[model samples]
Target chain A: MSSTLRSFGAIPAQRLVRTLLLAMMALLAACGQSSEQVDDMVDFSPPSEGVSSAEKQPPASTGNALQVDVGGALAAAPALPPAASLDEVAEAANRTEPEPLSITIPGLDLNQVPVIASGVTATGEMEVPSPLEVGWYRYGPTPGEPGSAVLAGHIASEGVDGAFRYLERLKPGDQLSVAFNDGSVTNFVVDEVVDYAKSALPFDELFARSGTSQLALITCGGDFDAQARSYEDNLVVVASVVA
Target chain B: MKKFVSVFLGALLSVAFFVVPSSAQSDDARIHLIHGIPGVNVDVIVDGNVVFENFAFKDTQDLSSFAGQTLAGLKVNAAGTDTTAIDAGDVALPASGNYTVFAHLDADGAPALAVFENDTSTVAAGNGRLVVRHAAAAPAVDVKANGAVAFTNLANGQEAAADLAVGTISAEVVPTGADDPVVIGPADLPITEGNSLIVYATGSLDDGLEVITESIADLGPNPTVVNTGDSPIDAGVPVGAGLALVATALIGAGMIRRSQGITVDA
Candidate 1:
């Protein structure tokens, strides 16, 4: 064994092969640690300061005069018998369902793409819509509602390009609109585009319900892992409501 | 505690005209007012003004804008009449929280009031919260989800809660330890993700027992990951296979060199 080792050491070709093996092992180690390092650098910062400042605006009505007159009325009024039922009043007060129809991103050349209400799958991940459609996160606020509403789409599926294939191309100041079933359209301007590793996604900030009204468009990006058959990073584009 | 109902009403009357202190808190409290008293139409007065007129059974009003303010002289009167039925005086709404205030009946069939602070905490991903409140004039009961008792012996004026997966559940309320007479429903209730579905068992059991619901949304947790694509259309390179192939080639080359060296020595 010692003579074989001496012969192997004496050969320059064997020495070059050993150096190449060491380099390959180092490369493998770096690949394994890259995702963790990215996760450590993940920022959980809240929304922009300008958005939070708008929430401090004063309310329109104070109701001061009405507050003073409430005491005297209760003492003056006598107890009366229950009146006849009016079932119509209850029907008029029922809650209305949101009817989001389609999304339009002219910058991405996506025109009036249909949207469907999507929920989480059995494994707790957001269910992606079909290649040609966008999915609105029905559990969150609607597109025009006052919260962080999320919309997800496929970048590509089965070698075909999906609805959000050009989602990462969205830049700040870019415009988009979401049309509702009621014939109304809500416009939004792009705020920012971010790319996050799948393991380092800021769940709290991305899914927050209380904040300035905003919309999030998401798709897969970064390097593809063939063994896993998925992308390593998520591309997110955030847009604020246009006043 | 036999005078629980009157004592609670008296507390409201004493504080009906008191002023609320101003605070710098900016939390928004979402409040929903539900009229659960069956067979009666009423006008809901808040701070001396009739906010809801001719409010019938199961009628709901969003009082979220009134959060952080004192509802002085809050009263319910027979429709279009000055006769007061239930006066919840000077009720101070919380600065931040989801709440539901119901004008319901107690266990003894007397008209009463209930203020339920809803659970608005973050729900697990793909799951929702279900809250059951007994605001009816009835005995203790068992609340069932899909024909199985999820909450047992839930008495009037009490509540039970659970976090369930997002789906539709067939809900029914029955007497404790018995399933023959299903009281409330075999109704289909959709348990949506990141939202709380609060179901109130209201009215008199013998008169017209029914269920009213309020949904508080945006309580769902962010998904751990969003895998949108099954194939890589734009993913620049298939890095995993590339790295593995390079590593395999390097290892195989080294083995061939070592074997050649050993053969030369032999």
Candidate 2:
């Protein structure tokens, strides 16, 4: 072989040997895996037992894509169905029978004992102006009278916490209901929730008998006086049974 | 040199073969396996019909189990899907142990399922309820339990939903250009008295669907006729005012008769 050829072969041989050694060193360096990687892999162990979390949990989906957008969580429903055009839902809701109060407000622990005549003030006894709890306080002189059918409740109490704990949160339009003895129920929509002191309650308007059917939810609010021991004020919700 | 190279390449080939297979085997290792429910067996029944019984799930089974059962549209309980019906027999009699029924792969309480036996059926649960009366006259939804009825006069349409709960409530919306209410109140509205019905007088007059006593003489003051958009709900409850009037009238008549003719006192 020529001297030139021999030198060239020798140079190529040296470079080849160097490249292999570099590759080997790189591979050895990688052999020491990262500690973080090891930890993630260990945690790759399937999740522990199932847990329902309160922290904003993404809703779990199990059905076809169109599963009524439960807003994902079972606790809450989607936004209120759009109020149909008056022409749309014009038909009066068919209420065949009157239903009595079905539930108590969540926070308050009030007793709703059924009695025919709402206990009148009788001059001496302090008239329990409001219901023990504030919900649908059914009242009537008769089922279909144009007379005043009064109702009262506590805006807040430690027991029920407040019959209308959410009263202050009410907007102009809300709803209410009362059950009649005639297997018929009366419904009312809230036009206003006015907070007043106990003495300021519209005694005449609230306590008087009216000509047609109506309902009121009374509760004490505005101010609570520790000395008087009663709410300094009251919350009066005025609603009328839809005509 | 050739021999050395050959030996080194052979070693590389051996390492690749052994290392690859070892990894492949480890990848298949399942250290832990848990079935959703103990014994994870299930049975499904619908409308007194057996759909699936003690069905064990086969891994990778989308829905049907080894029992050849399909569950996607099974009608469950409470909030159960209405797509299909599930029966008591189809449930895995969990040996009488308390088992949580989770809907849609849930692990909690079973949902209420609605059977659309008629053209329209309402499916509701918890604070949510839907009432649908496929029939024309009768109320589509009747709440026998202590729950709320959110929708009434639920018109026939897809968007007609209700958010009724358990309690007495009234909801009425007057259409534009409706009647001006008869203004029945002292000053403000919705006054509740023993004999009087309270209402907030606003907007044009929107009529109610209430049933007045058959006899106007038995009614209080001026009786406004109730508007019924659809057939009235079947209720035998008479308007209370009539009964009160009859009682009062009878007492008055008896006193007058005694003054005019014969009474025990007279």
DockQ (C-alpha based) per candidate is 0.10, 0.02
On a 0 to 1 TM-score scale, where does candidate 2 land against the true structure? 0.25
lDDT string for model 1 (B1-266, tens) is 65555445433432221112112223566666677888799987865568677888877766665554455456789999999888765455444456666788888887666667677787887788888889899999998899889999998777899999877788889999999598877876777767777777888878878776766777776666788777878444332233234334644664211111111110
Regions more than 4 Å wrong, model 2: A1-117, A124-144, A157-160, B1-266
Model 2 native-contact share:
0.01
For residues B125-198, write the lDDT of model 2, one tens digit per residue: 11223222211111222211122223333221111323333233333322122322312111111111221121
Residue B253 in model 1: lDDT: 62
Model 1's DockQ? 0.10
Question: What is the Cα-based lDDT of residue B28 in candidate 2?
Answer: 17
Q: Candidate 1 chain A: worst 10 consecutive residues by lDDT? A: A38-47
lDDT (tens digit, per residue) of candidate 1 on A1-243 = 222233234454354344334423332221222343223212111124422332343442223433344334333333322221222212322446655666778676665566788877656698777776788887778886777888898877666667787788899998888877666778889999999998787766776677778899888889888788888999999998888
Which window of 10 residues has the lowest lDDT sum in candidate 1 chain B? B257-266
Interface RMSD list for the candidates: 27.4, 26.8
Cα RMSD (Å) between model 2 and the true structure? 27.2
Q: Where is model 1 more than 4 Å wrong at Cα?
A: A1-138, A141-167, A171-215, A220-234, A239-243, B1-21, B43-54, B72-75, B80-84, B87-90, B224-266
